[model samples]
Target: MSTLSGAPAPPRIPEAVHRRRWAILAVLMFGLLIVVLDNSILNVAVKTIASPEPTGIGATQSELEWAMNSYTLVFAGLLFTAGLFGDRIGRKKVLVFGVAVFGVGSALAAFSGSPGELIAYRAVMGFGGAFVMPATLAVVMDVFERHEQPRAIGIWAGSVGVGMAIGPITGGLLIEHFWWGSIFLINVPVVVVALIAMALLLPDSRDPNPGRMDPLGVMLSIIGLILLVYGIIRGGELANFSAPSVLLPMVGGLVVLVCFVLHEWRTDHPAIDITYFKRPAFAAAVTAIALVFFALTGVTFFSAFYLQSVRGYDALEAGLLILPLAVAQMVVALRARLIVDRFGARSVCTVGMLLVAMVLAAFVMFDVSTPLWVIELVLLMQGVAMALITPPVTVSVMQSLPREKAGSGSAVSNTFRQVGGALGIAVLGSLLSTQYRGAIEGHLSVVPSGARQAAGESIEATLAAAERLGPAGKALIGPANEAFLHAMHLTALVSTGVALIGALVVAVFLPDGDPEPERESAEGAPGRALPVSGR
Candidate 1:
């Protein structure tokens, strides 16, 4: 094979990876797992962190909401900017830096002395997550060939379920044996390993000619998201959407978001391609993913409280009970690609959403008297439904875009999901609070005014107040539990409606078959100008 009068040519590096890709995927998944785990692990530990004791910080319900929302709010706000940043610079570099930053944030969060401090640290972690999240998916898209992409994405999506599964159980064990802070401290070692693996295994990726950063778009998105989320949180906490706290930010955020859309439409170099929404498949996929997260996050938020506060399960027991949901999601997610290939994304996603709607409706049956097995069964069904929907919807969105825009696409997808989650927690959490307070108000007449305000604040507070009252508190316990159950039923009904609406949207709009193959653009990057594919 040697050329005449010349030494043999250097060994060629293959353009496509066939074997090493899987190793790369493993590294990407580890990074994804930690980011996802941080989102849910705190859910199980909320009570422990809020307990007024030597180890607890005595956070109010509003403070607790801030603790969760701060992470998601900042995460959502920074995601698009981070994704663009990674694409312009280097995905692997940004990912590594993100992991390092996340590790530092985790270490600080573990030592937070107050809820406010924890919220600040969580926001820092979220900033790191914004960098890490999109890069992981973008790298997967870069490394894997088109044909193998579905399976790789399925596995990637399944890692989210794995994180969900591990978060609560890990948090529970750590909180039970050590302290609530240990849940965060555990991330440090994991991050160290992830950083080392990512550095060694991941190939660098970036858009060689990515346009200038869109500063206006970044500011608009960040301000819009934070304000909207803050307004929602305030509305829920105050139980008055008409109040200035709710109205001003909510309206202002909406206006700013509309302006952002306009700005993107007019800009030559936009952070996100505003025209992506013109594709029905892309739009439907985004909506489906967002709605699913909305339902899942809200339900998980209340379910944690219900399991521990209402049902009298300890943290470990509650975490174990929630384990079935994650288990079912992980198992089914592994098979989602096959199912989608056999059927279609449209069919699979539609069915999944309907299943989610059905599961939410089933939650109405849950109460203090409901059997543990029944609760587990319902959770399992919800997990299966999410498994079917999430992977297909995500893959569809990824497929709809050109590979060159993978970072931006991943950011948009994740931003919507995180925003939906934040809104879910805010809206549903508010509804629960309002209903619980209303229902429990009459029953709390016997209690002192000072104690009554504390009891009305949250289920956890009510339970804690009752414990202090001892015998008198025993009477308050039954009503408080009943109020919580009532609120759960209301929220479930609302969630059922939301899920069914998502199902309808997917069925009506999402295309029935594979996406059209993308062609290379004038600049040699893949472009999304191909005609839509049909079944």
Candidate 2:
């Protein structure tokens, strides 16, 4: 078969390996589980690892923030390039190598003696994750037939929610029985199992005619994403969106990203095909996925604190309470394809987004006196909404891409989702902080000036101040909790708007029905480029 550029096609997979596609999926899911787990597991472990007393690393608040944000920044920065590289090289090889690297990073992290060391080690884990994440989805797209891809993608999307739900619970359990390092140590064995299975069961696939590497594009993308993520993380931590620390990096990152797009559009060998965004299915699907994550991460961030701080639940209890959300997502995700088939992507995703918006609106009514059952019900509905949206959006995006560009497509989808989540945490957390500070300031006059500064800083600080002051401190607790709740309600209101806007975008832009699959070259060469369908 002759291509436009006349490059030789890549080698075909053996028919024998095709029979074990389901086994391949299991391996992929296991690898995916570990990567996704790391994103959330550390949240529950942070206090234990950062406390000044016994079994802690004596990390400062800033250091604790970095322990989480560093991983995310590095992961998002490297994802696109990693995916494109896997497409050019062998995806299976990259996946195995990534798991091995992640295991090594986890082992090193388990032995970290300081917060700085742990932060560095987490960055290593993020690097490994970038490699593993996109490769898993790309491999799934390769192994599954077009008709069966949606269900497979649904299961894949469900694994992400499952890992997220289980992370905090698993961390809470480990922290109770074992050392603080146990959380990181747990990943080693899991990664080992994933590595072994991946090696044995997965088939290697790559774009045979993949052109020259776009080093400039890679550099720009990495720099832009890192700067953008860094700014967001710093903004949330400092609670000052207008500060130079936040605006400079954020604006610089945005400018560089624009440059990256222009460069990609002009380059003969682009890392990401800019034309993919022109397809309504691809663009709308990515937007929907990003919006879902934006809501998910934002709500989860504050709600975890609300459960433990205001509601007086233990860490383990809080994790358990959130488990229903994960369970609901898994159940609904398994049936997402059927829903999409019956109602179409536009209707299903739009309804899902609106459902999430409605739940966020309900959360605006939350206060210190709100019942636990009400919160639980909201979480359950949010999970169902997420399940409905994520799988179909993912399936649509993957279905729209050519087989050879699957890695790039997966990376783009995942990157946008991660960035959206990061922005949600940053922007919403900042809003919560600002409102909490303003609401509680007037009430702090009863406390001494020396104590007032610490008291007004955060809900935790206020509670601690109240505890130290005895009855007077206790007096402050009620008002402080109320203030925090007010902030949470405001944040929820903002999130509701964001979700509704996402629904509007989907309703307006996304096309209904399953996209027609592009036919392969007549000679069955997988590397040849096919004409994409117009929106």
Candidate 3:
């Protein structure tokens, strides 16, 4: 799938050798696993390392905020610009450069002297991740023709699910015996192997006419995304009605985003090429993917906290509790392409979203006293729902576009997902924080110290303090625990409602596969676009 200018068609590797295509796909999947794992590996380590060497020098709530958001904010901001650059240059070359940059960033993060240093390095790592992610998908589209693409992407997507599933467990194990920085160091060898494989297997690919890169558009995008993410993450920390810290970033980010849209409309070589949104299928597919991450990220964020904080589970035990979700996700991921091949993406995605909604609602009954089986069932259901949805929707978005624009198209789709993940954690986390704080304040109103805030800004603090409390304090903590769980229940309910809305949107706007004539010949099959056949 390399798109060299005036370059002759590459000699196809013989299928007898198992084809170079699958090998190339393996290299890309390595890249996908690295990027996806990086997103969640720190989840289990955050609680362990929030405190600095002096015990609490750099362990404030804001510091914890930087530790998590720094990576994602930069990753989302740079995604589109990196894709545009990769398409302009060669995707393979860009990926190599990205690997080198990420390696250096990882080393710095591993050896970081302070929390601030780690945040800076994390941002650098994210910049590199932006390049690797889009390039991987673009190469897949280039190497595998439309028909073979489903199977190829299915394998890649499944690996991603497995990597994400393992990330928390790996982090938990490493943190138990090692330091927080071990998570970053572990990426080094993986990157080295990935870089070598990529160099040997991936063919060069780039847009035929990439045109000029829009500097204005790039700046607008970065600033807008950063501000939006920061505001969302810092929600409720500002003044009640209209605080500048909150209002400025949220409103200003929106303005900058609108300006970016206008800039893309006017510019000849827009970074994102906003015209893609005109296609209903593309829009629906991206939305579905984003919505999935929105729910999944929120669940992961809160569930880890609930397991460790309320249930008093160690990191290993918490990770083990989450194993069912990952296992179910992998099982269902293997079947997605088969289901889509038989039924089509439209039906699979809609049903998948509804299933997620039902699963989330089922968890609303969870409490400090809820049985473990109840939690396991919810996790399993969510895993299966995600597994069924992610691959087909991603495949549809990539296949709908011409091969040349695959890099940009994949980046656009991924951007939605990253943004959704950030928003979900920020919004839902804020809701829980606000509710927890109010609950503690109300329950401890009689304390002579005027109800000092909980240590470490965690809901778990009240529950843990219960052990040392007098009879009166013990009574107070019981109400606080109830409030915290109540807030979590509300967050889950809101997420379910949003997911259902996304499902309805997909059903209304997205059409079934009706392969157009130009696409049919290019795809080299008739009615292959129709409802998928049997597995």
Candidate 4:
């Protein structure tokens, strides 16, 4: 039944097969959504976990940071290699395996007794996620027709918005009524349902002509991504000009990544198909996508904390406050196919990126003294921009590739986005922390020397205590809060710059046309024809 031969008879599309494909896509989407949502939910819970425990074991600031980073670090590191593996073996088999591993890891995270245990389990979950994410998109491409692809992709993209929307609200409610662990435990039931659906619906498909796995290339990618992310997060946290520990990994990671580029250039069939960059459309779309996530992920990570830490909202309240961003993203995603078909990727993405930048700039203006509605309005504007941007960008990338290589093509696109997100969190997060300290130090300088020492010694603790501070202490805290808000504003400004870069990149690079088909139609007709685009 190979579709490789140009004259191979057109395989009849059985009705049952089409039904099964749709069902499988739905199940996979559910599973993938749960994984995406978990990444964001923890942002709202960080402050809640850090309180009362001076040792910061269950919930310290460092522990909270690790809880989030541990997952992302592993996810980005393994994505490229894992995508190749899934294509070589079988997408369904790989996905089922990933879901099981993810479920077990989630359970382990929920029951983790210490910060170390939680970090370890989160890493395990990330490993499973690596396989799960690539396989889901690969299978979707395989099962759907080219005409059906955009609509399906639009739906797929919307899952992220759905996941993003649900994470905060559901996570918030669970934390409010239950313990922090409940957030992790919540994945189990959802995963179980998804597993059942996948088993029943997904087809078994493997690469018709697979290549050998590239071990050295895999190692280079993993090491390069890890060190790069480590340097950024560390630099953001410490922001020290003279620290060897921070500088070493950061510099070392960049060196390794440079070596990786050289290695890929020389290898036959490199683990990552770096040659995709040769296509202007592919290069431009990828750059725009990375920039897109750079802005949104930073906002998602920081704003969640801003609501919880600065505004003193509980988990649910913080989640509810960020809901607009998610809701707007969802509505935009569902309709993105129609929008892209009419306007082209360049126009849609350009407008979207510009809007996102504007919203981010508006956010930078917020202060402790600023009203809450203004923050919400800015967020709403950003939400609208993201809604338009993400779907078309993804559709553009997929359409630019040949169908036979759809799995790897989508994987490369996804890997870049994840890498950008990891960097955004690291870079922007560091900026916020650095600015926060500077603002805190500057404002506290106006305080008497004795009080300044206390503020300097334990900012997190003092901030916690300041909440209970009476009017006089509250007076002192007013400046501290303003400093914290100011730091966040600087972060917003950084995101605005990042988004602006993405808009220009998309405008310059992504091709203008009806989103080109990833699965190109067979050339000629009847007996004299090319094979169906996918093997």
The clash count of every prediction, one per candidate, is: 0, 1, 2, 3
Q: Pick the candidate with the highest TM-score.
A: 1
In order, candidate lDDTs are 0.84, 0.83, 0.73, 0.74
Better of 1 and 4 by TM-score: 1
What would the per-residue lDDT of candidate 1 be over residues 6-41, giving only the tens digit for each residue?
655322213444347888899999999988787668
Best by lDDT: 1
Find the number of clashing residue pairs for candidate 2: 1
Report the C-alpha lDDT of model 2 over 169-270, residue by residue, as the tens digit: 997888888888888999999987887787677777888678888999999999999999999989988889899999999999999999999999999989
What RMSD does each model have against the real structure? 5.0, 4.3, 5.3, 3.8
Better of 3 and 4 by lDDT: 4
Ranking by TM-score: 1, 2, 4, 3
- Rank list by lDDT: 1, 2, 4, 3
TM-scores for all candidates: the values are 0.94, 0.92, 0.88, 0.90
Q: Stretches of candidate 3 above 4 Å error? A: 1-18, 51-62, 236-241, 445-451, 454-456, 461-480, 514-535
Superior candidate under lDDT, 1 versus 4: 1
List, residue by residue over 24-140, the lDDT tens digit for candidate 4. 668878978988788767777776666654323435455566677788778877787777777777777778888888999999998777888988999999988988887888777
In model 1, the worst 10-residue window by lDDT is: 526-535
Judged by whole-model lDDT over C-alpha atoms, candidate 3 comes out at: 0.73
Error of 1 at 357 (Å): 0.8
Instruction: Supply the TM-score for candidate 3.
Output: 0.88
